[model samples]
Target chain A: MKKTTQTPPSSGASKESQMLAMVNRRFFLRSAGIAATTGAFILGACKDHDLDPDMTVDLGSGDIGILNYAYALEQLEAAYYTQVIATPYAGMSAMEMSILTDIRDHEIIHREFFKAALGSSAIPGLEVNFSSVNFNDRASVLGVAKVFEDTGVSAYNGAGKLIADAGYLLLAGKIVSVEARHAAIIRDLLNPNSADFAGDDITDSNGLDLAKSPDMVLPAVAPFITTMISGNNLPK
Target chain B: MNIFKIIDEIQKVDGDAVDRLEYATRRSFLTKFSRNLSAAAVPAVMATIVNKAYAQSPAAIDVLNFALTLEYLEDEFYKMGNAASGLIPSMYQTVFRQIGKHEDQHVKFLAGALGAQAVAKPTFDFSAGGAFPNPFSNFDTFVFLSHAFEDTGVRAYKGQAGNLINDPALLEYALQIHSVEARHAAKARAILSEIRGNADIKPWITLNEGSPAQVYAGDDNTVQGGVDINGIAGKSKEAITEAFDEPLTKDEVLAIASLFIV
Candidate 1:
């Protein structure tokens, strides 16, 4: 059966209720005129900010760990894409420019999505040091692009099973699909003759896909990533 | 196309009129009419419903062992593959070396998770019953084995996802490694297919745009046309789309392990 419609909240009703709740006899007895002013002042402080401190930097655990894990990758991807867009490679094709731009947007969306979704559990905006990368050179950009995309795809594939919530799994799948597309495009850029773009990276003899735990992936990603990011709080 | 269709259907379910109706249009007459329409439609939809249960099997003792076994297989394959001096492209030598280390790490990690009390790691044959008797003899064997090994690892990881969900920590770590293995698999396929100018890396067992074991024969590029995954009720896809990998039963995985295990 279809569910009933949810009731919508009236604008500022909740705020008005709180303001009145502060007007008890204790307020009149405490400091008369100043109590009313103090109550209003306290209400003003309760307003929420765009950047919540509780969510800006997560310490890792359960869903927070996963969010932080995703947050770190988003930071890396966003930085790379930002560089790509800021300085397109020499002789960059329109298609390449357009696709890379779209990829950049997607990465930003993903980064922001994690931020919004995690709310109070999101990690702080990470500091990604990709200073060694030369964005103007096609080969250099593509090489790093290949590594980053491949790494992203691997990261997703390895983390899928750890999620118990199907909702989260579905979200991860959506992101992974996009990441795979990015990997394919990057691989194609590296070598048009290379069938690398349209291939499987982690399969086995009986035609099974390989998965690894974060404990394994972090050490590998650690060398490339200069900063030490913790995901210890991700659900065990 | 499938995704578009699904979204389209969802939009239809939400009804265009409902979206078009602004908050200001919540008058008595329109609200009553809409409410009646929804009430009428609900019963019709409810009457034909069949409650299908997608009952999932919990992680079996055997599936874990199966995963450990696959890990062993990949661990051995990479060790041997890396040992081949001229086999790897000079440009990709560093890539392969790093991949080898990653695979070793995966094996060790799984070994640790499984613990000493966990099932023993399977000993791989590395030979597919003389199908490719001398894999080390030539580049073709290397290519074939590499492709096969990587493909198998991808599926194996996918197959075990359900079983490991109960162990959140282990599952999380396993997923991290799974992604690395996928990269390795893709890399291996790219190298092999590029050498032959085939340009196609979709395995014979994968179908339905690489969903693996879900499409028709002519639809995919598999050499075998199509092969049903035992215990799993579907045909392998063209390249094994990253969508859903078939879950393997404990018995099914153990049976495969027995073939290679000493």
Candidate 2:
């Protein structure tokens, strides 16, 4: 029954919407403040961010464990993107710089959000081993970005069933799509307008994206992460 | 958008809903109207309708069938777009082919998963009742509609995640499809950016930025799990909104899907 309202939000209209949105945010936040201070879920063991790589950072089981798992991945991504932007690859174009910067900001936001959500249950800052990556080369930087983004997407996809809390599941649902978005852009940067953006290697004959369990994801990312991670406690 | 009308309709059904939604989490009700609200004055009634829609859903099968219906629409849309003569440029044929194949596969997967309970595929009108008179024959319109369809697919699967929570395996499957749809969305959005030469159009959605409004209604939401995503890492509101894709309600998604259904 709806038609002919095609002219979307104009700049002036968006500004007004932005103001309206701000008011809604305050009202929403004020009403939700007390309840949002959820009890900190205790996991296996907590470590200061400075913990040595030798120490096994156990991602505690259940819902919090999944959040930590996600946090760990986000940490890896944020760190990688941070370094990429700090010292960009050789011959990086303005578009590349702009896109990667946005990605960096996004990964950081995801990492911080999870860290905040998990509270004390969040795992310590993970130590990454980028010795194998040559940051100066665009190929090297983007290649790793692809791996991390794709891994994050699949890991979140696989971890969905393991998350018990509805809030947490919805949270994972929210972030995984963003990661998938990251994965696609990174892939497109490598091969613009090509099938590799959602290539057959990652997607199956049915076109379903790959989904890997914690066990599967941990090892895929193990090369980049030097810190010991224990996922044995994650929900089966 | 009957967002307010829906709220008014909801008030007739439940009285305390407005009060309850006032204190409820964004995932519950704000999510439904998150994208629907414009810069204009919003009535207090948006909350009750939000909560009612958020709180309602049937069995896993019901959700799956709802999903199957969307997959069917996408599958047929792509199948037609792919077959249209001189529609897709040669450079992007592979991209469109891959996306179409995935949609076809999703239809197969969901149908197989639903088995006998699967609903018959509805006849589709890609024009959206003449919204895009040349969706297949016109390249820009084709990609534009593809973006809308794929993005809608991502949100549609997400809106149903809460329903499948009780069945972990089912939920995981839905999520797998959900991310794949996201990947497709990213591909389509990127193609659109390249086509339209609009640098502002990133692969991820920025705010409630997409068309038809309903498909991308709540995407502008910066709040996640009760946390205001603004000021995190000194990111702009646009980046924060882009970082997290919000869930659309089943009712709104149906409103969108209805446009394409004959």
Candidate 3:
């Protein structure tokens, strides 16, 4: 779960901005070089974003659109877990700490994987608003974690049909189950020795977990981020 | 409300529409059966069209039947385990009961969806010809098998997502059930870890480490989408493997399931 890549094999062996460049690369570019070209675009958007916070970031069309949709969610998850680990809640057990730490790495890896796969088509790093989350309190942090993990599973489940490529469908399948596992572990932590791991609320009497459409999933996660994500171009 | 009237509307759009319906309806074509049918018959006739429209395609039917076979195994396995006195420890009975309930529902749901096409539940030898001599009698052995079944279910459902692609509704249902199995599997792994006092057996599969090693084949792979992602974002190799669950093809899954099938 330890996440530190002092140097990417591909990115330049440049000066002090390596740290800044790494973060920028994840949020803004496919590689360190692409950052220069997308740089102006990012700055203009930043000023426009400052003026109009409601301008939507459109998830493009076709498989790229679906990939971007997924990329966006991974960004949110990676950011959240990164924050959770950076500022651990009070009285966090060794077991809980380890579990959350693994989840954080998985999410970041997921985020980076999509970014790498999407290449230039990937959406920029989303601005998160975690004012609603209380990182110091275990209950509050876990509550948000539960919601995020469960929502992630539902989003992937629902988005399967929108994926036109068989490879992409299988890839989405690869990621969702891991999210479900993360969700189960977090739920177990909240209520030990209970069936809340596959609780009745997220799953139905038919025993199927929730499969929600992008429209349904987008709004649920909207509160967690300050940036607007317009899923209008996403495949139905 | 009126079959002929609806056909007339359709004919206005395309002169040969009724002929195509007569041919396209396949098993439910009504014109061949009753040429003098009245409007009252529209209700009955239209119902057949609606039903056939939702009927599973050949691909989906195969996947659903395969899924049904797996669900039947899980439902029966858990039922027997939960019913066995003093088999599941008092502390973990509730967890087993809940899992057993979900498997039961999965069986009924899948069988109901398949209806006449549903495959009969195979006679399962939980003992696997003495491979698992005391599946129900031994609590630890039972937990181990439980983990295997749940994990297999997740992989099995996932492998068939592409087959169900043409049928969106079926694909969605498969996904919904797939993740539920994952939830059950994670809990089972955690319980097994507790039973054996092994922290190495984490909720997520750590580099294909688990009993019934075949199920975890291809799991140690850090490559995804033809790219070596071991060091992506600087995460450890274990995290890379744990981040994604690999799918087992239908043939692969059935071979594993056949161990218990008589």
Candidate 4:
């Protein structure tokens, strides 16, 4: 369940140094004001479009909106999973440890995939601080885990329509099903009867539920993050 | 009289004609009075019209109606699947009951939202018009129906994501429900894999590889294909490997619903 450390590619390019440089540059940007703005301008050109100003957590345009919307959730999940691994929950069982580590790896992969796929259009890697979570308590950690995993699945389900690219949509389906798996495992671990699988909220008498837009999720996630992030420019 | 009473009496001085003239300068006093009388009677005449207009407006009521329908389908399927005792294992009864309860909760939640009664469950003919009949004769039936229901539930949630964006409370509620659906889908995939064995380890599971038949629902393009016997098509490696849910147009969802409703 340990994260597979990336070996330098056959070309011998060391990612460690490169990542260090990236971090240094990020620090430099945060401190060096007007002078750094020039480099930042160049970087911004290559940066993904920020969340759309109009992208409220509502569902209007399908596919693109959904993907950007999911980009946001992945951002949160990647952040959470990153912290959990950084600080292991106390009194963790061997099984919990293994599963959680695997989940972290999966979240990182998901986060990286979205970033790469989104490229210049993807959201900037968000800073997630889980100071409120008690890493020493199993209940606290699992409670947060349940909330996040559940939110991830629901976020994808709610944003499914806003995706435009068939390939991306397929990718989302693949990833979401995995998230669903994570949710079920966590649910079973939490309480036995909680796993409903294919119940009524999603499928209706007519077999349908609503997909929300970024406007809906941003405010909803406000309590979790320190800085405000936008979902406006996701997809028009 | 007190000073206030004196002021009141003076203020109440016959200003009715002046007020009438101020409101309608062009009208004779008699004509203005008559017009006021007519206008007063007009609201009573238009009350019926206003009520009719109000009745015709669609709200989240449409969303509730949609949920009501899907719940009926899900409820009936689980009930019927459980009833055919040979088709389901005794061990899995708890699973079915748990899922059934979720579906029932969903129905109650949606019905409560709509302030309406639950819709009666639909009679699903797993036999596709008897052309390629009931495929789930035993264990395969449960798997097929379970997978189909789970898959359909996931897609249906995707299909309806647009409808609940306005109300934050309901949006959160729907999201909570959606996560449960995803969990169900994953569990079903696991069960299907264990039951069928040699199941493809695709990222997403599908019923057919070369045909339009799917374990959940029809592909966007396949109009004709051999019907799957378990009421669901078998698994496809490519289906889940590269599978993502397709977002449907509002019109498209409406059309799909039309097939089930009278």
Candidate 5:
């Protein structure tokens, strides 16, 4: 007694175009490195800028810092899922395809939400390196998805306390539950009918979910992120 | 000299001697008397005062007790479902068993934290006052009710975060449990999807799902931060609904939970 609302596969196409745009822009910047730097210098030469905009963006401090940190992770996830759906794994069932697409859309929405919420303070689009993930193999792809989802959940759990703003804290709370849902689904696919849903690795002996600090999470995800993302400024 | 002996002697000599002493002399005597007590005794007194203060301010305890109640309900519901013969399919039996264990652990953890303040587990009917027909006996009814309970559990924890804001540790703890509930909700939804052959049943609650509609009422919200996300390019109303899980107020959560309570 239900109909799976067919979400037009726009996210996959949009992601492709976005990647192309980024590649073109990076190519332009690299070829005209001095010229681009000179232009940046002209813009900042008149004012005493604290640091070069080209340098690695510190995730700021306080609530904004936490938002940017989340934005970075969302960017990675959105990109990963976009690729997953754009080129699905071998022997992917129609059911698997549909759920992964839904996950893709959700991640894109999350990425855009953070981008719009943070606006200028938000870090530039992160370049993800999915070299380790073999998109053609179902197990390989799902393994990476599992890592990203689990890490995303723990990241939000860890960062929730660092957000002093009530609005931001509530937003994080809302988003993390979705992340947790995603994590569970992917885990069930990998190891069905097991305690992997709340696995000992991610949960404590008390059954409480693990809350990894920014420092702990950044490095784990860094291998997937090509951009030098830093969370040094996030609240302790 | 023992301070108690001295006080007793003074009382024996004249009942009013201590009271009639100069104010400065009495102050000095009390100061000396306190100094004679072990250093550890001070913190013991302070601990008693802090404990009393914590007991007095029941907001945190109330939040915990409320959580315990929900956990107890979930634990028992799962136990009944798992124990019911043929209610859960062989393929999904382990899943139910694992989830039931988690719920039991949650009850234990929350009860352990609340210590003596933890509320006793209430007897549950699961049939929702006849709203559901033999929920435990029937697998379909059991799955439907499990979905509701898990979804409600997620929102209940979300609603209590504000109350826990003052204590970061408690807030973090509540959030950790909150996500676990969401995961459980998703697992239940996935199982339903597998059984029904409907891919539309997402792990996250969408605007359209939730049997009574009240489970997902207000979850369709798209305008966050006063910006219409649905209006944005490529984003649909459903995407917004799936992106963020909506919170349920204490009244709303209890209302749903109360259905199962006799």
Candidate 6:
């Protein structure tokens, strides 16, 4: 079935240009020797609060911790998809573009939702390092997309119990299914008609999807994130 | 007079009501009645009560059994589809095989968890009483039913989350199953699109997908937590629908599953 060419409303806003500007500003700030000082100052401030300066950010405790945890992952996804659309993969079909753009918007909305919900407790904008990913190659991009989406679904699943608040659990449930949808699409794009959709690695013999705790998940995504996330205060 | 208070008052009045009668029986009756009352309306409140009802949360076990029943149906569906000769396309045989294995594993895992409490798998009629006959013999019929079953399974797992909330480990496990079911749903839809040459099919559920509307019911919802998601900047109904999947109630889920269960 051929998908329609309708793009999400924000697709027209030129997020790529904004992302480039942000990158350039970061470059300028670093070259001026101000970035380290700013980082040090933030660390010092955190120390005054009895927070560990060694860790980039502590996710806090209880429901707030869970929300921040979700926020951090959503930030990674939004950044990754934003980059994907910014530099479309070679030989990408219009259908691929449309669906991926939809996924991009969904992740951004999820990221923004957690940000809004957490308010002051939310972690700062996470800097991502996607140097390992080849954005121009469809296989490379889709392969990464599959990992992110599957990881995202499992992360949310694992964290559901950490959220004591029923409202937050419900919210997590809402988002994970969408992530699953993204996972399926990315798998299909990489190898259509392959069993990759419910691959044995991510899913167990019982057909249940894998669930990884923050301790397990944070390290897997660590390479892509420049900011060190400490799940120290999060619920065990 | 409050019925619960009256039950207490009866013990005070006769003083022998507790000694002479079976306390366990009376208490069980009260708990069941209260739960039934709660289940009548306001699902969010009912969910909280159900989850918190721990010593009473054998109710949770009941929920697990319900999940196992659905898993059994799905496992058999995929296994049968894979076994049917010349039914599934050559290109798609491996996909069905993998899905079938997962479903079989799901059945085993759930049954293992339930142990002696696990319910036996019921006989399933894939054709829904001749609604669509010879499903195993027709690839199109099989594909369409597969989509329905996968989607139903996703919702079925989601519907039970509230019931399992008191058990954090179990709740997380159920959530894990829920997402896999969703992945299965997406894959089935994608395959259907490929076979039909319909480019309009999306991996995610859209507002309008035509026929079998029950699958998409409540999916078009835009209002969540007293906020219209569409009211947010750069958001629309379509985007809102795509953002969050709606959960089916247990009754709603059973009604759908019953179509296949004899």
**The candidate that achieves the highest lDDT relative to the unseen native structure:** 3
TM-scores for all candidates: the values are 0.46, 0.79, 0.81, 0.49, 0.78, 0.77
Predicted candidate 3 versus true structure: per-residue lDDT over A31-120, tens digit per residue = 422211111112122321232356678877666678879988988888888788889999999888989989988888788788777655
DockQ of 1: 0.04
**Which should have the higher lDDT, number 4 or number 5?**
5
Give the distance in Å from residue B62's predicted Cα in candidate 2 to where it truly belongs. 1.0
The reply for model 5, stretches above 4 Å from the true place, is A1-54, B1-57
Q: At residue A142, what lDDT does model 5 achieve?
A: 94
Query: Is model 5 an incorrect, acceptable, medium or high docking prediction?
Result: acceptable
Best by TM-score: 3
lDDT of the structure predicted as candidate 2? 0.75
Tens-place lDDT digits, model 4, residues B165-243? 3332333344546546656666665566557773452213433331113333443222111111120112122322222
User: What is candidate 6's DockQ?
Assistant: 0.28
| Candidate 6 colliding pairs | A1-B198, A1-B199, A2-B198, A2-B199, A2-B200, A3-B199, A205-B105, A206-B105, A206-B106
- Candidate 2 C-alpha lDDT tens digits along B56-81: 32366567667887788788988998
lDDT tens string, model 4, A33-78? 2221111111232323443465323311233345546766766776
**What are the candidates' individual DockQ scores?**
0.04, 0.34, 0.37, 0.11, 0.27, 0.28
Chain B TM-score against the true chain B, each candidate: 0.57, 0.77, 0.80, 0.57, 0.76, 0.76
* Residue B160, candidate 6: C-alpha displacement in angstroms: 1.2
lDDT tens digits by residue: candidate 2, A12-126: 4355335434544554454442321111112124444334466788887666677789988988888888889888899999999999988888887787677656555568777
Per-residue accuracy of model 6 over B83-188 as CA lDDT, tens digit each: 8998998998988888788788778766665555566677788888788798899998898888888887776777678776656656876898899888888888
lDDT at B244, model 2: 87
Off by over 4 Å in 6: A1-55, B1-56, B208-210
- What's the TM for model 4? 0.49
lDDT at position A46, candidate 4:
32
lDDT per residue (tens digit) for residues A1-236 in model 5: 00012111346435533543454344333433222111110112112213346555577766667888998888888888988988989999987897798888888778767766665455766667889999999999999999999999999998876766556678888899999999998988889877787677777645678787899999999898766766776777
